[model samples]
Target: MNTNNVLRQITYEIYKQRTVMPEKMRTNYRIERANGGLLCDLWFLTVGCIHDAQGGCVMCNYGKGSGVVHWDKILGELKKIVERLPWEFEDFLLTPSGSMLDEREVSKSMREDLCGILKGIRTKRFIIESRADTISEEGLDFVKKAVPDAEKYIEIGVESSNNWILKHCINKNTTYEMFQDAVQKIHQAGMYVTANIGLGYPFMSEKAAIINTVRSIKDVLNDGADSVVLFPYHIKKGTLLNVLSENGMYRCVSFWSLAEVLGYFSETELSKIQISWYKDYFGEEKSYICSSPGTCPNCERKVLKELDEYRETQNPEIIRRLREYPCSCHAEWKQQMDRENGQIDIKRTEEEYRKLAEIYKTDRQLLEQEIGIMKDEFMRRYGNE
Candidate 1:
């Protein structure tokens, strides 16, 4: 979506209003105070370090096949960017990919050096991403020593608390115990944490899965994680989800349902949280599974409201056929074709998306072509074209 649009402004607006770290994870420094300087919170690094068997992103490929990304050339460029970037903000963030951050042993020195470079910057906030299993007292201790006084935010890829849900559904390796252990250690060292979670992974009953995901996030927040990154699933071509998309497997919950859940979060919980790219995946104003005022700060509920009005207009015609039916997401869901051709748009209403907090997908580009496609599609679908 055009960054200049009011809808797009949701992102910067959220960033602007977010005065403190989120509920799940937080830093010693107030995110609010530094909001103006966030433009300078540049992430300097190579994207080739991480690996996701399918690819770096859930939807696209970005690993071994993505050409060569040497650590030296990477670091050299990183140092240059760090130097060239205005030394304005108290600090900047270092966001590595699932593959880059997941690399071990041979990649250790590079990772350490990357941290060293960030520390040398003298920024007030320094963050890194790591799988739950990769964190340990030893490595964190080393990082602490190298970057003392900087509030370290270790992003734990604890996509879900349910092991079976994570392993069988998302193919993630880390377990809940591992997540707990990492959080414990980070807290012991007084470091901050941001646990990343996938709200509505496929194959699970939407209601059960969403409730479980929400509770788990609350559990971590209960543990005082500085922030929680709730990434809903997004369906795109070339993914298992994409394959299942035709079978209606990609749809999880509606943004409305997610909003209901967030609305129910305790007030003490509401003010403490912040969001990251709440709706960037679509590059436009679109509907995601999750869309509470706080949860999806980037989505302003305009297009979604349009979709809702479409459904409401179909209610009478839908009930004429279902007879015993009440107005609902399912009544509307079953009549999708009808909704499209003037039969009635009822099917769009009954998607029952509230079962999970939200559903959305993000992709990573391994080449100019792939990036262009995603970027273009995002812009086009959202009206940039």
Candidate 2:
């Protein structure tokens, strides 16, 4: 028998045993490439989760979200990787799921110890994915000590900025107050903030999206977010969204609209504000989709490479359309800044104003059917003065 095959079988058997247990917390994970670099493949052997007493996110699968046994064993596997991999590469990071369930004090101590190990190994960087609510002052302080001087980014799934939508429909159990506090703490820790935001959910509106998107970039969100992940609403299996779809209580955002959202991030206008934060971090382009935020700096570098390639392949027409796209957040921002700076020559052209109106109309027709059935309710849920 092949030695590799035997090892594979043994690993699979162990994964299966852990997975099939009634109280099973561990899950099998695929060793996939993070982005465009080496040493970025997450070898997820010995990975797992600790579930909530209330089950978990209504949108989560017990398999994809779960099936990993524990973060400690996962950490051990990474340590083994450091022992085995080529010496030239940068370090691997540690990230955990169901992060809410981890022992707070122990987690901090473990990360401190991890920092000592990686520093000894001369690793380059480390990052993590966590909940907005879990990012307490104490936790931020701990992470700061451990990851001191590394280029760190924290990805928080903020979902939506609208308190009503996040509270009533999504049931995330987080408050706007908590989100604000987390942002302040993250900033205090001297790290980059990445927001995981979504749009076009059940009661989401184009205008609300515009306002929230702007708030995220301009107000509190701008203060922290280095990159904004514009996650569109996709129907998943065994989730509240899927149930809503089945009962016709919701409609998914169109793929075209989703493209528009991406365009929002790609705009040169956002570049101004994003740059306001990073005075020295200047470049012509917008954000890069870091393949694995918490794991691979190598992949992140490659992601920047690919983003440049993507920008090169696009035509001026697409770019212009993006410039004119409604919520011309970038241009509006420039205009607003110019006004404050006493440079008043900048005004959106009549055509530009009309185009923004057209964008709203087009995006609104997206919810035509459901809105027709529930016009007053839609207005109450989504409209702004």
Candidate 3:
């Protein structure tokens, strides 16, 4: 079967389960201060990301969905979770797989019903997800008229400004132009725009990833997005990334790498728009899986605590301070980065061996023939060695 059919099967299997918990749906909630006050950040994960279902990105396996779920049931489950929230959350952030506003995922009636549901609730701001292609005036109108009391913001997962990475590695069909147009439409609709920039995809150096992400952030903001969210790539179990990692092709971004990216942006640059990391969404655990930046056992907790503070504060000084902290494992992380960039010491050593073989090739048996034999053996054992 093709990728889409495989994804469909996976989603079908998930929906076949008995009851889908909010977390099972990949939904979770957090309380954060936004929109000038503390708000209940409620996230309900729908089946899987729609883009992922349609032969999605390489580094993603979040496509597991329960197929076509009843929108009212989803709303009911969401309402219960909201009511049960302990704090008085004034803002409600609704996140769904792929584009929640996508008609195929959330029908017109579903959007209308969701609007009606929010109309009854007292939310100050409603931040929702939408792919650039899925943004619709009708959907916006439904949300606008239904929740007249709340501010509406649309977040687009532009991922990166580098179309190369988006098309080749990520396989995201959307383009920068499409994203910009979506921002324009959202602005024209009188709603706010938030650009979600992804980091750490294949075929880019650590610096390149950071630079492209920063560029994407600026591009989206310039195009009319009011804020930006940074998502460092995480390795999931069944994604293409996992396969690559198994085949010695990909590595997860280290904390040092993330810090490097964060440090690249000045406070002035970062402050232009509201910025945040996925770490703020579901905590450190959710932000990464295996192959994390190896922090020393002694300072790991302290480092993570400080990192979390920096993520929330966006204080350049915080990142600067974190970057300065001495860690023995940083050398390992640097070496890992080098390996990822194809700068392995073995490659250099292999080059030196080739040079030596060239120099000794004139000798009969002492150096030339023996060196040639060794080179052949080495190359045979470790290609190009």
Best by TM-score: 3
The C-alpha TM-scores of every prediction are 0.58, 0.54, 0.73
lDDT of 3: 0.62
Cα RMSD of all models vs. native, in order, equals: 16.3, 15.2, 11.1
- Model 1 lDDT vs. the true structure? 0.47
Superior candidate under TM-score, 1 versus 3: 3
**Stretches of candidate 1 exceeding 4 Å from the true structure:** 1-51, 54-68, 99-106, 119-122, 145-147, 236-238, 281-385
Clashes of 1: 33
lDDT of 1 by residue, 1-385 (tens): 0111211122222223322212221111112122224423333233333333322223322112122345676566667666665454553555543322455522667767766666556666666667776777776765576557777778777776755445434545456778888888888888988887665555544454456677767877876677776655555433445444554655644444344334445545544343333233333322222221121323335434432332323222322223332345534433542333321111221131221112322121222243344335434443531
Across residues 1-385, which tens digit of lDDT does each residue of candidate 2 receive?
0011211222232233322323232322222122122223232322233322232332332233344246566566556655554443242344554452145413555556555645533335445656776776666665566545566666676666655445433545565556677777778778767676665434344334444554544443445566555554544443444544555444554323333444555444333221101011212232111111111333334333433333334322443453344444334433543443221111221232223224334344433332243344335664664
Give the runs in model 2 whose Cα sits over 4 Å from its true position. 1-58, 61-72, 82-93, 100-109, 120-125, 145-149, 204-220, 250-252, 265-384
lDDT of each: 0.47, 0.42, 0.62
Candidate 1: C-alpha RMSD after superposition: 16.3
Residue-wise C-alpha lDDT for candidate 3, range 1-385, written one tens digit per residue: 1122222332233233324233345456667754345656555556666666655665555435656565556678777776676554456777665577887776777667666556555666778878888888887786577568788878888888755446544666677788888887888888888888887765445655666666777777677778777777776655555555665556766667667666667677666444344343444555324444436687777877776665456566877877777887766766765665432233333343334334324233343343354345445544752
